[model samples]
Target: MTSIKTKKILSKAGYYIFVSLLAFAMCYPLIWMLCSSFKETNTIFATATSLIPDPFVLKNYPNGWKGFGGISFATFFKNSGFVTVLSTIGIVASSTVTAYGFARIRFPGSKIWFSCMLLSMMIPFQVLMVPQYMMFNLFGWTGTYLPLIVPSFFINGFGIFLTVQFIKGIPRDLDEAAKIDGCSTYTIFLRIIVPLIVPAMVTNGIFAFIGKWDDFMSALLYLNKPQQYTLALALKLFCDPSSTSDWGAMFAMAILSLIPVFLIFAFFQKYLVEGISASGLKG
Candidate 1:
């Protein structure tokens, strides 16, 4: 019995050690970057093999924040924040309503519409990129944030799919009970379905925020002016082929760029698990 207990303890310790090593392997690049962000610019690559920045230089943050072409990173951050926040809100609100309609309402052609929405998820974005660009250009929205923000309000196929699956997991009896209690469909959605799907909505919000925040392609396609550039696009400007790229400054800003994504995930992480599980996903 003592031998069996000892073996079990050994097995658990081995498992933990293996997981810790795997996690460290995955995070080594990030740790290296973080350490490099504090190193002197010229010595960054010279001492690249080292994980600890000797005498920890602190100028990278200020230099990177100075930005390019007389424009600071503050502007880039503001532009990104504006676009990401608005786009996220639009996607969550529109997707929630669309999912509710598809999941709860029984109208003619509902299945057909839902099938089309699902089909959209399979289509590559590259196929639609050109046509979308032309349409926006014709509407005179190409140079504006309209192209970035407006489209998000219309539809989000993944968001709809996720919320629909989650809503399906909910007992229909509660909806029926609400109806019997003189609740209109709108009221039922507002009071009952919405509250119940908070986890799903949070999951959707996190996805939307991250997608929009990291939307370099969309911003590159639409925005022509420096003032309108988002953080992702602005990062590209830091690389000047004509001159030496400030690797240290770039790394500093890159680290700053990661903070929002990290914070959002950190705060809403529980909802992600709950939402996935509630949507009937399994390991």
Candidate 2:
């Protein structure tokens, strides 16, 4: 028994060591990028083998911020922020309403419709990209933020699925009790159901925000006007085929881009995990 216990301890220690190494490997690139962003251009290449920056510098941030097409990085940040916030709000509101109906309300062909929604999640975005672009062009919505913000008002498959799972975990007794208290469905939904599902709503909103913030392909395909370019698109402005690449500034911008995502995740991480966990539990 003592030998078996020792073996189990060794196995657990080995498992933790493996996990720690894997974590370090995954995080190394990000760490390297951040360190390089603070180093001088020459030092970056010279110290390529070293992860630590000897002479730390912060000039890359200001240079990158002011360097992109003579436009300040603040403008790009504003554009990205506007689109991300609007998209997240629209997605959360629409998905919540749609998920509530699917989970609680009985309507004609609801099951089939719900199944169809699930199937839509399986379809790749590439398949719909061209058609969507054509449709946006027909509406003359290209080169504007409308193409990014408008579709979010419609139900998103992942958001709907997440919300539906959360709502399903809610006990029907709450609704019945609210009804007995002369509360209307709208009131119950707005006041009670929404509050109860705060975790899920927060999770979905965070997910939507991150997606809109990080989106590159959609922004690249639709946004033609330079002024309307998001931070993700603006990051590519540093690329020049003939000139030496501004690796330091590019890395700085890349690191800057991650700040908002990290903040959002940190703020909502608890609720996101809770929502996911609760959704999987039996009511």
Candidate 3:
């Protein structure tokens, strides 16, 4: 019995050590980038494997913030905030309502609609990008944030699917109880369903915020003005294939861009895990 206990302890220790090594390997690129941001631009490539900067400098932050063509990096951050926040709100609202309908209300073709939503998730975004661009351009929304924000108000495939799964897990008796108490469908949804599903909504919001915050292709395809650039788009400006690139500033801004993502994950990870686990979709 003692030998068996010792073997189990040793196995657990070995598993943890392996996981720690894998985690460090996965994070090494980010760690290197952080260190490179502090190093002089000329030596960044020279000290590729080093995690410590030889001569630390604060110039990268200032230079990156200065931005280009008289626009400040603050503008990019603001634009990202505007688009991402609105988009997240839109997705959560739209997806929750759609999910509730599909889950509780037995309408004609509801299963068909649910299946379609799931199918949408299987289709890659690249498959629809060009046609979507042309449609938005026809509506005269190119060069604006409308193209980015409006579609989110209508539908989000993964968001709807996630939420539908979550709502299905909720017992229908509460909804029936609310109805028997003379509550309208909308009132039941608002008073009973919404409150209980707050965790799922928060998960959606966190994902939507992170996804939209890191969006580069949507901004690249629709936005033409530098003032309208997002952090992801503005970061691209640091690299000029025909001219000298500012690697230090790019690395600095990259680190800053990741801060919000890290913070959101840290604070709301419990909700994320709970929502996914409850939804019956966890892999």
lDDT of 2 by residue, 162-271 (tens): 88999998889999999999999899899889998999999999989999999998899989977889999999888878988888999999999999999999988999
lDDT scores of the candidates, listed in order? 0.93, 0.91, 0.92
Candidate maximizing lDDT? 1
Candidate 1 C-alpha lDDT tens digits along 102-220: 99999999999999999999999889999999999999998999999998898999999999999988789999999999999999999999999999999999999999999999999
Ranking by lDDT: 1, 3, 2
List candidate 1 stretches off by more than 4 Å: 281-283
Q: How well is each residue in 134-227 modelled by candidate 3, as lDDT tens digits?
A: 9999999999999999999999988888888888888888988888899999999999999988888989999999999999999999999999
Q: Would you give me the overall lDDT of model 3?
A: 0.92
Clashes of each: 0, 0, 0
lDDT of 1 at 144: 97
Worst 10 residues of 3 by lDDT: 274-283
* TM-score of each model, in listed order: 0.96, 0.93, 0.96
